[model samples]
Target: SQKTNIKALLASDAIGSTVTVRGWVRTKRESKNVAFIALNDGSTIHNLQVVADTAKFDENTLRNVTTGACICAVGLLVESAGSGQRVEIQAESIEIYGVSDPEKYPLQPKEHSLEFLREIAHLRPRTNTFGAILRIRHALAYAIHKYFNDNGFYYLHSPIITGADAEGAGEMFRVTTLDAKNPPLDETGSVDFKQDFFGRKTNLTVSGQLQGELGAMALSKVYTFGPTFRAENSNTARHLAEFWMIEPEVAFNDLDDNMELAEDFLKYLINYALTHCADDLAFLDARFRKEEDKKKKEERAELGLLDRLNFVVANPFERLTYTEAVEILIKSKPAQKKQFQYEVNWGTDLQSEHERYLVEKHFKKPVILTNYPTHIKAFYMKQNEDGKTVRAMDVLFPGIGEIIGGSQREENYEKLMARVKEVGIHEEEIWWYLETRKYGTAPHAGFGLGFERLVLFVTGMGNIRDVIPFPRTPQNADF
Candidate 1:
């Protein structure tokens, strides 16, 4: 029979039966006459303990069974006499597939800082913290697709390279294969973009919302789950040069409908993690508490990991206009005491401090702030009749400031084009996008959720880079 994964073997009820398990050695201990190896296969957090009598194995084989080594252990499944585990393996025979040098292996049977683990990202998955985070990340992703599909949303694949700038932020990574030292210049002194590979300038997509809207126009509801790039030279804990985004666009949906969908979708994802990733979550929860214990007592979280997630799914998100939020913040102790770094203002963008205050301190729950100032939002957001704000909304979680940002799109062709032009976007570049509104365009809305931020919130990871396997930040693209 084939070797069983450690996760299955640990959960198996077939005690006294023979089984073979293949995994990496997390830890090994020698008790003079017997050896115990903690083996993990990446299927689950718990390791299957394999007890081997020293007399049954050769000296060379026992010596090679060190941390980070790969091995195959054929043993009898027996009830564990240990305190932590229910079952373990009584080794009949052991095969050392690969030996890891104790001095060469960066990972050992010790606690390592997140910063050190990032330096060795290729081997970080073997760590308990990262393993739990990745498992939870997978569960969240599965829940995202399942929720959208069950609701009849078509999965749309947006182009990785695009000419359109969805956010109009002008912070995009250009994709060009033009020779830097050679020819290819127009009559003007500037390099000719027309002579480039795409026959024009092109770059990595900043967002898939624009293409998602195109799909939604036909499919009624569509979603895009893929990588998005930004060229912003920010080194914040929250910013990433390249990260995955989940953007869902729905036609014939108003701002309220969009809010409802976002709330439901977020709840579904959190609930799914709670149900499917219980063990991983529990491990991460304890890990979070250990980290929190180092902080000041006043800085501790009010709710634990599972409680926070359950609170989000069980309770309704508090909804209010951005203007109203500003009014509340202006009168807040932080503002009144002048403790806020950014002063509370009616028209300016809300900073992370302000967002966290609203969700964590003021509301003490998830908040959905709507009707952001038009000048701060993207051009696609529907402008209000008062010409001051847009139908934009941002869903702020307790720990994560802004988990989702979405809005009702401008269906009016003339208004959208005027805004596009006012924003200095080349009119000819997005003629196809404009044509959608020119044709039979219906009211629509969508929002984007940063996938890594969700993982950070769920796993209680402090840094965005810690949750992602290979983080691409400013000046850091290490594998």
Candidate 2:
């Protein structure tokens, strides 16, 4: 058993106290008779330094113990009066437990590209940046659960496979047990597999919103947090083939109520990440600490500095309606003319460029755009009194556009059925959803939040692939 708590001991007045610690060596420095090595046990980002006599231990062992080798050391906790850090452990005896092969290991002390890191997904967690990202990921997940639980929302598990395409966009990745090489054929040239999966064809679910709505009809309020797949062919920073989605549906609620819920929920998550994951956040902040380091030195010399971490943690997101946002974009026509891929039309679905401009330049903060054209949106959206637009909204952040997409659902069966059919999907597939309105439908609303996009926004991470553990993209499943 190790004799001391590395965290407490390093943080205490107990300098030069006997202790023992086991961790993988990050790096080592050696001189004629003395040596210093940094050790990390995944306890925190800061490494504990162990000082030892190079002449005392086995010479061959010391030389062979390259980077990434696991070792145990009996040492003394001493104040690091020399420099670098507060305090570290001074060693008397060293023991090697595991040997990491030098030639085969991919990661070294130097920087590695994101593309290369994806190739070594399993080993990437050992890096400080990924470790911090994952820790924040856990904190964010817990915050989601905590916020919903405290607010009287039931956590509901929805199915992974469904017969209906809920989003009305056929981006589902099909699932089948039938042979791809030799599929059952009808007299027609096309393959007819009605005899698959007990009868009708099914595919991986694109969203749990429909099933979640069922739970809301029965229980008044429900939220589903699980994996959703998309077969989108575009190789962009914003799209992922398979990622997690958070859907919260409510009964007796309108679009206004839904918008309020989304804003509050997002604020709660950002607050949680900043509060609960301090060490992780610090580690993340440290990666961008060059400016901070320069500022600290300049402080004594009498100068001003920009506190980036403070700004991120305390910043309040701005909000705007869809029509208002469009007006702002139209005014910022210069930025749009050169940058946007598509023209910024008034009633058309807001392109990613328009969304980014509203949040990143015009508002200078996150903006929630509400009330989009019904024809440009999904069939389930509630129609506005204007006779053209729907009660749809998207939450756009500074760096990422449309992190969340949600709205008020059509509670009236007649209107909903009409829209569903007009959109050209088989109404029989969502017969149960339509029947919810028939039984005793009340006003209901909800939203779908992309989990990876949120992570990217919070971390200032440039790529969606960096936010997820093992990204599943088109023709590239490296893991």
Candidate 3:
């Protein structure tokens, strides 16, 4: 018989059928006459109870079936007598594929902290918490693709290595083939990038927005979902050396259209998770509550995970301008009481604390803040008629402040070139991007959603590193 996945088996009613199930043992409980083995194959969060008669299997083989052991059990499918699950396997034959020594194996049948799990990330997927997170991650990825395909969006593959800095952050991981010890230098005594692999200076792309814009100019509507890199030295829970970004660009769309699209897209994704990943979400919700319970009374969340998600999906996000948000923040209790870490000002960027106050305390719902100061926003954002603000928008969630950030791109060629020069970027660097405005440039807008941040919010995982597999951080790249 072919091997049946545990997820399919649990949802089916094939009673009295002999079947084969392959998985690693989660736990083994033995009695005088029978042994109950909880087995999981990383399908669903639940485990299948395999009843093995002690008399039917060799003692040595059973001894090897400890926790984390890989095994194949041929059994008869029957209704489970247990309380938690509906169906179970009655093992008629057992085969041990791999043995895990209980004394040395890192993962035991107990609760392990997230910090410890990071140390052994290679085997952390076997844990229920990580398994549920990974499953939800897959579901969210699928929902993103499905939603885009259904809404007439083409997935554009942007280049991994780029010459122009999209965000103008100047924090990029250098991509070069020059020798670090003794490399080529020009007459100016500077490292010559002309001798590099690409024959010019290049680095891992920081954002696909610029390349994605090129696609949108021709394709009318396009999105790029790919990995991006940064070389920042921060080791915060929210920061990562490598991350994935989802950027959607549309021609002839203004700031209002961009806001509408972001709101609808986010709602669809959250609702999709609530519908298709109910089981995993339930597990994560329970876990989220437990973690929240450990915090101080004042620091605890106002709503549970499921409640927060439901609220965001059911209601509309509050919309306001950056000026309004700053005014509100300055008058808020946190600001008046001097509790905020950073001061709220008109021209300065809003910090995470300020954003959370607007979403969690002020609006009490998701918010879409628009019309940010031009000095605080990117050069590509359309300059407002006021000459102080740009048509930029940031979608803020309850726990996560800014889940999405975008703007209406500057369509006027003269204005764009002026901003480019004002930001100290040479015209030769992004000549192609500048040309898009010169020739038949229609109003275009787009936003970027950090794929890891979305996963972190959906899975209710606190740390950004926990959501992505094999997290790349400063000085830590171990598998």
Candidate 4:
């Protein structure tokens, strides 16, 4: 008996061998002759089937084990008799490690709604989808560190409680101690933030790019991979109130350099995910995808398990300037008159829908959309020579829009301040930021990649909430 991955056991080499494994019973079926229990131990996405005869194992013991009960078993591994599965365990010994109370247990082997699953967040990890997601998340995280470390980039930890809102989207989750009903006020009658939790108007960081830029200035290359909070109330599948972002900032880099770095970085991530999270990827491919998608995946698997990601990582992303992108849109979909919904004349922020159309339809590959209007982009984006567009780029991929948004920072102190003023952002609170531009801020560039969004693209999960372990939404914190 040896410890082995369930997927490896089923698909690879463990036939006609005895193995001892511990796992939670997903569900069990009992009969007079034998009983079948589908088990998963977090080793892989696929469950290890355990078939035991009623004569050898106590019927009462098997009957008492609930859907989510933890169990340890020693058994002979044998090939499946029918077309059900590849491998199963023939039990020689059975031990009920922890019995689950049936009435209180949330998982019941039924297809539960995602909302329902969110409510049982504590136990949802036991399911196949979540199990695969966590594994992929772990592998991707490891790959990120490996990618940065191998490339001579310093790994910098940005503070969670920060004085800056980097996105400037005004989505900062506030951190305060003043009572909402009756709070202490300053002489000016404003709520006194001095007595707050951080002793100032502190908030959870919306993005780590700004602090990461500091490290980039010093170290030349640095990345901050950590949790970022957004107080945005959007409840779409793509948006999350709390999630992780990997912000890699580079010094003396322009928008082109930034796009190249982003492309390489994304490919590096996809490659790492493919090699390391094979089991998880396989699990997700089989279980979560729709019937047609699963069949498509099966056919794709015949080509390769990582074919889609391989195409992305190996292929050169098609580059399109914002103007070219707009032209392409105009020529391609002139019939749709709702371009009015975009609400911008020639230069403006490209909405998510526009980004999707460009990547999913026109490019049919990852697209690096660059040279956006300076008015819509962040203030830090380096002003292009045209005196209008900024050297900014948003990497959009098929099925996912704006996977990474970045730009070459505005190095000139005066112009930086002017843009800051133009944005109506309070310059007083962010003096340290201006100082960077003043004293030795080497033309820096960086991008913010939503880690969950990348997971969605890589795993083909379609929803950001499904990839994160515990999705925190405005009205949801069920478990």
- Candidate RMSDs in order: 1.1, 4.3, 1.0, 3.6
TM-score of each: 0.98, 0.90, 0.98, 0.90
Model 1: which residue pairs collide? none
- Choose 2 or 3, whichever is better by lDDT: 3
Stretches > 4 Å off in candidate 2: 3-20, 187-189, 286-317
lDDT of 3 by residue, 251-363 (tens): 99999999999999999998999998899999999999999999999778899999989988899899999999989988887434387888778999999888988888778
Task: Tell me the spans in candidate 4 whose CA falls farther than 4 Å from its real position.
Answer: 1-18, 77-87, 101-105, 286-307, 336-344
Candidate 3 vs candidate 4, lDDT winner: 3
- Kindly list the per-residue Cα lDDT of model 4 for residues 178-294, writing each as its tens digit: 898998899999988887877789889998887888788789999999999999999888889889999989888877788888988899899888888877787666554453355
TM-score of model 1 vs. true structure: 0.98
Tens-place lDDT per residue, model 1, 1-479, is 43788878878898988899999999998899999899999999999999999998889999999999999989899999988999999998889999999878999789999989999999999999999999899999999999999999999999999999999999999999998798488987788999898999999999999999999999999999999999999888888999999999999999999999999999889889998999999998898888888889877888878788888899999999999999989889743437578887899999888999889888999999999999999999999999889999999987789989999999999999889889999988888888999789999999999999999889988999988889999878877
Off by over 4 Å in 3: 334-336
RMSD of 1: 1.1
Model 1 clash count equals 0
Q: Model-by-model lDDT, in order?
A: 0.91, 0.80, 0.91, 0.82
By how many angstroms RMSD does model 2 differ from the true structure?
A: 4.3
lDDT by residue for model 2 (326-424), tens: 777677767456777877667877878778777666765667778888888999999988988889988887667889999899998889988988999
TM-score, candidate number 4 = 0.90
TM-score of structure candidate 2: 0.90
